[model samples]
Target: MSIPTGTVTFLFTDIEGSTRMWERRREAMQEALKRHDTILRLTIESHRGYVFKTVGDAFCAAFTTATDALESAVEIQRKIDKTDWGEAPIRIRMGMHTGTAEERDGDYFGRAVNRVARLQSAGHGGQVLVSSSTQELLADNLPEHIVLKDLGSRRLKDLDRPEHIYQAQIGGKEEQFPQLKTLDIRPNNLPVQVTSFIGREKEIDEIHRLLNAARLLTINCPGGIGKTRISLHATTELLDIFHDGVWFIDLVPVSGKDGMWQAVAGALSIRSETGIPLDNTVIDRLKNKELLLILDNCEQLVLEAAETAGALLAGCPDIKILATSREALSIPGETVYQIQPLSVPSAAEETQGEKSCAAGISEYESVRLFIDRALQIRQTFVVTNENAPALAQICRWLDGIPLAIELAASRVKMFSLKELYERLGDRFEALNRGLRTAPPRQQTLRALIDWSYDLLDEEERELFMKLSVFTGGWALKAAEVICGSTAPLPVTAPPAWRDFIDPDHNYTYKTEGSIATYNDIKPDLDVIGLLERLVDKSLVIANQTDGSTRFVMLETVRQYGEQKLNDSGKSRETLKRHLHYFLLFVENYMTQVEDVTQNIWDTPIREEYPNIQTALKISLTEKEYYEYGVRIISSLFTYWQYHGSEMEARVWLEQFYPFPDYIQDPLTRTWITLMFGWILSSTLD
Candidate 1:
């Protein structure tokens, strides 16, 4: 047969379980192989295809048109499925792909040839798989009874991008076999860890229990808290429990819902045929396999991941998903395991025994981890009485975050434990010694936070930075008042509030007086949704307090946000808004004091004291805003008297005394004078 050149469609065929047939019925297998070769060749010739090569029971043929190639494949499957050898049935799997190829010495070679072979390998016996290119060429031209089912995009061996695959459905009595051997041959694809896995014994057991009870388990935690490590360790322990084997799919490189399933198919070595939806291919492949799929780094693509997990759980009964993300998938049957930081010894525990300092230090999981990682770089490093306190201090400073601890431990070759602890105050700089092989985001604490920050939309990013104004944390109502203002202060607002606004630009604020209402804002950038997105991205954490949710950031993340706010050169304006909002918040509470109990007003004020103090500090420094500062401090005088320091209030009043010229508000001026007089009397008496 003559080899075809240029854009030619290649069809490759091989028998399923051919080796087993040869061993069980060697004589009958030879006869069956002969019949398979005869039927394939005849079908190719009839469809204007040329058989280029034949190896054992396999045939490689080429045709000028995809229609001819697909037609030949369908006919071969039909003929083989109907024919019977006394002992062996000739079930042939065929694959067709269209691409440009070079013909030399009666042979075909190039990516097209290799692709067709991979496609053939990805099919079951009596099934015909076609590449998307071939399916497109044969679009609306398939013979009656020949239909194409899209299998979605797939990452074939050695290919950079995924290729769409399709299955040629020929209605008949053809035998339906198990999933393609190409996908099932190598079920597990977990990466080998370079370092030893540590701790999480209880976590591993609990994960096992959760997996047994729930079809989907997501390990949720902030970056650098060790979610990935814990999931990997837990999966490794449960390897034997899964009969089909455990597979790991890294979704960091995947961007959307389509790419997510492609990653899963690639990990399972399932090369989807063109024309069939990839999700369908995944569900079909996993429906019967009792296996565990570990999806890592799903936070950025959480919505897509959640949808895919939900679909898989609903479609595949025996497939369980163990996903590692910054937050829960929120799908039905999903059990979220929030991974916490490793435990660090308390100061008392660190100082308990001088002679047994090393033993005591090793007892805490965080310190033990630090020492182990430190030994990797500095072999002679060991815990002793001289450095136990510093070691404990280092772990505590890093908040027992595993990634931070590992990065810090990497610096032991240069800095002493004490020096490391001292430098941790500027953790973004101290944690820069990450291993070169680590991912870019894990290279520095700032980079880790930057990654999560970059994923936010404009409004979300703005809200995140503005949220840094709160030191401890703030309630949803406070966030709405402070950071939810997308529009500027309206012209109709009080002149005192409008004075802080940029008069050069138009300003519009949400309707006044009702703190619970969020309807008077931009529909696209709702404050509630932005806050929830921040929480979902693990940038902000939500805590339950007195039946309400309070959102806060980790100290490290807040510092990063503050740095971003400073870099944006908007810290001054944001602080102004923060101070203005808090002043109004206090005023509103004061007016309601007659109807509400002290606890009602004091509880929230006490919770926001740190934020109020931060705003006051910034306000006090701005000479032009000194009057506003005095007004805010005076408005909260009762709060200061009941819940804060009377002496501190007096000091603030004295700071503003020298700037009386800036005091435009008469009531604020009089209140400041009265507070100053009372502080003087109390100090003297």
Candidate 2:
């Protein structure tokens, strides 16, 4: 028969121990080859298949349908298993996939063809494997007595997407196979995943393309976006491109330049010369090695990572780097790919019935990930129609973030899905699950944000906490107006406490081990400069809308900042300032609303409404800011009445009916903002 072309099933077969067979039994192998060729050629043709190509002892065949291809594979395996070749017995491994093919020069070729070959390479002797694409076609149809068993998703070399494989098991055959040799086919230090990777096939392909195009590819994502997992998955699929093995260098512990190069050296196990610098030694060792190096957690040491990557590329021509960071290193010749949160099903999808809900979740990445991870924690966990809505809402509440989803999923052991859904209203505390094997920063939701928070300078951290006063997002001008606080300069230059106990300057070292203490005079801060650094570090997200920029912190991030503000004893002052800022903002906007030239206040109020509402809440509730809240509510009283808010201002007004108290404490504000012993890490430590 002529070769099967479009929409055909391709089969690839190889001998498991062909090389050893040829070396050990040269005389008997010639006879064994006759039987091998006869079995493959005859069995494949009998199943209405076409033999397109043959390389060495490996046979490549095609069939019009997956059933025909699978039948051919099963029959061939059984025949080989039963054959009595005595001393030169051969074991054949087969792989198959169904896809459209492109035939040229009397031979079929395409991605499907390449995929089948890799599928076969991942199997063992006397085994047959089928891709999900093929397995779907053979859903109920079986090949004789063959039974199919799922092998899960496996990364195949040269394939951008990982393949979901099903193994064909025959009865009466002791069916034990070693780990399917996919990523392990190459030498790499990638971590062994404990759970099946859930989604991000498109992202993995994009990352692979970016790596192929750029020598240095930095994956920039916020904390807990699964950038490292995606990078590792993508890197595993492209191991064939690297000659020397791929290496993973974790930069979490590498804070300085020396630690950076040494981390690289440690990853590559490069030996250093006595007189040569470690950086030079690392560069020299990798100068001629063709490898892929994954630098994980570069955000903690962004500068050092940039410098190390730059120096290595400047010296090593054949080395490539893949880095994951919360921020990008703006170095030349670097390609940055920002990873977004996984997809979540829309609210509309959740409204449908259970059948539709399951379909909806399967179509989205975030829900699938949550389900996959939840299974590990509680095997009996299954999403039912009654609870499916809650599950979908949980993903939405977490904003489709993978880390947050995983953390929430881990709580399946303790709480039901509905109970877990209720807790998401305060996700920072609810989803603070920790994995002991993870880095300290990755142990909890707060710790992850704290990593970025600690990296900020004092002013940046201060501004970050102050900016949390607003909700949704804030404008630059708004942040400056509400959050900016400049330090007061002293009339006389008083040496900081560190100077008082210094032996060289003060000669005040009273005795040995006396333990000198010192306090610092914090430098003046500018809002504009600190905001830039905060955005660069990924603690704050900046977006340009209608030629104007808006800055935002993630929900959990904003919560952490709020917690920090509360702990610092600055919440009252900050809330009063927030109250005062929005009070004036509304009073000015009311003038615009009164203008017949402008239609409605909706345009200005729609985006900033949340912030104003937050400010109003603080004003109404706080004893000191009662009048500020009264003014804000009074200004919007007519609008709220006209729009007919479900809960009228009257109801909310009743909650704060009692006259609030006021304690004016400008002295306490100034007193707490100074050099106190609260900051304990200084001078004599």
Candidate 3:
């Protein structure tokens, strides 16, 4: 008989636990194997099916129709159930799938064949499992004695997607053997996490609730913020609720919207036949089933992911989607859960006297994560009074970001806790090493920030690169003054403006009558809109303080932006603008320091301390700005005295003031001498 091509139904059969039976009774097992082969082949042939391949006690066959395949599977099971072997009983498990395959050399090969074999493996002895495609084809054509029982969706080995499995129940003795082996099984495709999932108890519960409340929930967070891990933990916890099976579709490998549905189809094991449209096949197969789909890393394909999710939610009422991206999908019925960084201990908590070894460290999620991960690299590692503060500082410096913490912790094998704390000053270089299995972006602190940075538009990228000048965070006015450029920008500019204009080119600027040169045009930079966009993208975070909004970049993100600034050779120019702006700010605030309310005066200065220190350091490096640094330092005397930061003030004063260049103006010199004497006296006593 010739092999069938095009759309065909495959029936794969195997003896359940045949190896044990063969070991128990070799002679009887041989007879049983012979009978099993004979019954399966004869039934398949009688039902207009051809037995293509057989190995030992298993048989792989193909039929032209699902009716014939189901009939053949049932007939084979009935014969095995009733056959009287001399000393042993034989039971066979069968599975069938209807899909198009190529006919070559009297054998077939394709996803359909692989799927049918997996379906067969998902069943128990005396049971027949069929793919939803084959079951749908059977429709009203199944024999009266054979009924299809829905076994629900299952993830088979080597298949990217979950398959909706059904079992064929034959009447009489074959009707009752044991429950289908795959019945209690839940489809879990999540990668096995090597390390324990620490912290996020509240987040896990909240995400679970959101998923239940909303059909489409997207976990929005910046890279390395643990969105994927959180979503997996939540999905794993809620697996039993999704009767059809929980499926994980990684969209990182998928490019655009064109491939989104195909990725989903692949994850669901829904292969299209010769003439059928894949999207239509996916919708048809999933419309009635209840399942959860986890779409990971959708930031690169946000629009496509959103569109596909919208389509799926619209058509499939019972299907729920949980996606992870740096931004939201923005579709109707979508719940955007912004994942925050792990909790870090406050300065007060860090300074609190140490109680004991590993004491109170678990209270902060970030600290707990760091400790746990550090122990992975150094098995003897433990948090004690001596190292607890350093650990807290490490977590805080990492902004409690899970990936950052893990990368930092991985270095415990090579560095001491105090050394790690000290090295965080160069965070990008310190936290560069990451697990090899992680995505390229997640391989290092710099790479993760670079991934997010590369996704920005031209204007956003420009703003991000310049905003690195600020140390802690910046007010809108400060950012606008420092980052905004009044000079003309090229229409088609390179990554950095410095890269576009070459000194050798000698391209003289000419504002001619008819055509203006590239250097004569200025692009309007919308600082507000760009900052808001950065906030939306999770690159910048905004905080409302004292009736005004303050924008801040996490330390890791700031380091990344600063690196970009230095690479573009804009560090000095940007830092000049920053120093000039803050110098003017300090001079203006000096007169009001006495009359200003304690809360009001202290808050702004304390917040701006990091930027001020950054500016002062930048100024001391250059002769032209040395006076600006001394003047700014002298102006903050009242701030330091009032805020009880005299020791810190003394340290900065000693570091910069004791330099060679003497004070120029008598009044300024007198004020600096007096303040310096007072701080010195306080410190010496």
For all predicted structures, in order, the TM-scores are 0.61, 0.67, 0.65
Error of 1 at 516 (Å): 16
Candidate 1's residue-wise lDDT over 1-685, tens digit each? 4556779999898888787789899999887777777777788898999988887788998898888887778777667767767898767788889998755446665556767876786777778888888888888787877888777775454233456887788763334555443432344666655565556767776888798898889998889888887886677555556889888988888998899999999888888979999999989988999988999998888899999988988898888999999867888888988777788877666546742375566667888688767876876676677788888888877878888889999999999988888898898888776778899888888888778887788888988998888888988766776677645432122212211122333221111243322334342347798888788778888899678888888777888899988898888877876776666655555544542224424466777778777777877878766766776676565545544366777777777777776777675566567667766665564
RMSD of each: 23.3, 19.1, 20.8
Q: What C-alpha lDDT do the candidate models reach, one value each? A: 0.75, 0.75, 0.76
Q: Order of all candidates by lDDT, from best down to worst?
A: 3, 2, 1
List ranges where model 1 is wrong by over 4 Å: 1-187, 196-202, 256-258, 272-282, 344-364, 380-397, 486-524, 587-602, 635-661, 665-685
TM-score, cand. 3 = 0.65
Angstrom error of the Cα, residue 393, model 1: value is 4.9
Give the per-residue lDDT digits (tens) of candidate 2, residues 1-685.
7778779999999998887788899889988998899989999999999998897899999899998898888888878878999899888889999988766545664467768987997888988999999999999787557778998987775466789999988763549986777875467877765455656867886887788789999988788888888887788766667878789988876779998988888877777789889998888788999999999989878888899899988999998999898878879999988787888877776656743465446557888788767766876677766677788888877878888888888999999999999988888778676777777888888888888888877888889998888899998777776677432212111111111223223211111112211112232457778888887777788889889899998777788899999998988777776776676666555544532223334467767888988987886665666655655554554455345441556544544444423323333222222212121212224
State the local distance difference test value for candidate 1: 0.75
Evaluated at residue 554, the lDDT of candidate 1 is 77
lDDT of 2 at 534: 82
Give Cα distance to truth, residue 144, candidate 1, Å: 79
Q: Among these predicted structures, which one has the highest lDDT?
A: 3
Models ranked on TM-score: 2, 3, 1
Off by over 4 Å in 2: 1-69, 72-181, 346-358, 486-524, 594-602, 641-651, 654-685
